[model samples]
Target: MTQAVAADLPIWAALPVALLLLLGAGLALTGTLGLLRLGSFYERVHAPTLGTTLGIGCVLIASMLYFSVLQTRPVLHEVLIAVFMTVTTPVTLMLLARAALYRDRREGNDQVPPPPPPPRGGQEEGPDGTTEEMAAMDRAELAERR
Candidate 1:
């Protein structure tokens, strides 16, 4: 389809769209670099999630502004894409992290932290031999447990 010439775009709309596209591209590049440079799985997951979400948001906002101004009507397709992305990205991150944690723990990876102690009633001793309230225990008793 034939597109409108750049000359048709006003200074008001052109400037913000240009800035937003640049900002979005920079954020996406940062996230990509973070994913490559980070050492651990947990750390690696965070960069892309933040980067892509914010980057896409900026780009989408720019698109909305450009099309809305050019057409003289509200353009909203970006809203749906933004909504789906905002909702799903973090959720996918959590699911991946949890799965990795579970796998690492199951395989007895030393780097993973120990599971939290199970719930206890009042002052019952946990399976690990420490009580729910360690503060109430004397130093000698605490040492004895260890």
Candidate 2:
């Protein structure tokens, strides 16, 4: 943001603009820190979204407010850019993450789903897809009929 644009802003507006800018910077910094410090792969995937969403949003909104008051016009281009970014960032992030997962799976990395647990004593499945308990009951009824 240009200092010239905000030179004429009143203290009330200036305070908010400065505060918002600082907040935006702080969010972005936190996002970067999270990406570096977090241990899990999935946790890292979502770290930058904080910056992409609220950090950039706050900065853009502050710019919009500043320029609108300074230029005495609507200062709408920033708003449009902000809207576009807010909507697209998450979608693109998701698509990228999904693509990475697909690639990893296709390449047969160590990301396979865990094996199904062995059936327990009373819950063993029969070959025909019935449980052992049910098959045993069926056999008892057949003997009675005979």
Candidate 3:
């Protein structure tokens, strides 16, 4: 069982904790604002990383401090979650961006960069003996044709 203390906390200790919590809230708000204000998909993708990384980091520090002070035991679970999120979020974002690019390219949309040219010297000869370069077909159209 834990007992609550009514005594005033020291300025040094209380100040840092309060500052950390305020910083975390500020970072979260900034990240959310970035998400709303940024233009384009690629630009928007970078906004949430600020919250997931820095905002959560500040909050985690505050959690560790509060828990350690209250229970007299180090609370480290937030560290694990922070590490996992940092490692996985970038990978997931990369995959999603790649998938979006692929989909857009398949639709012949001009928003994405053009794919690399096909290999040379594999041209098939037509009935008229003229050789033609093989062009990549739209993925969605190919799927529909199939």
Residue pairs clashing in model 3 are: none
| lDDT-based ranking | 1, 2, 3
Q: lDDT by residue for model 3 over 1-146, one digit each (tens)? A: 88864545566656777788899889989988999999988788889888878988898888777666656688888889889988998899999999988898999999789986543444443556522322333343355457
Better of 2 and 3 by lDDT: 2
Q: How far is candidate 2 from the true structure (C-alpha RMSD, Å)?
A: 11.5
TM-score of each: 0.75, 0.68, 0.70
Local error of candidate 1 at residue 2 (angstroms): 16
The prediction achieving the highest TM-score against the true structure is 1
- Which residues of candidate 3, in runs, are more than 4 Å off? 1-10, 118-146
Off by over 4 Å in 1: 1-7, 119-146
* Model 2, span 1-146: residue lDDT tens: 65554267888889999999999999999999999999866678889889888999999989988988888888888878888997888898889877777777778778645333444455455577656667776665566558
Q: Which residue pairs show backbone clashes in model 1?
A: none
lDDT of all predictions, in order shown?
0.84, 0.81, 0.77
Model 1, global lDDT: 0.84
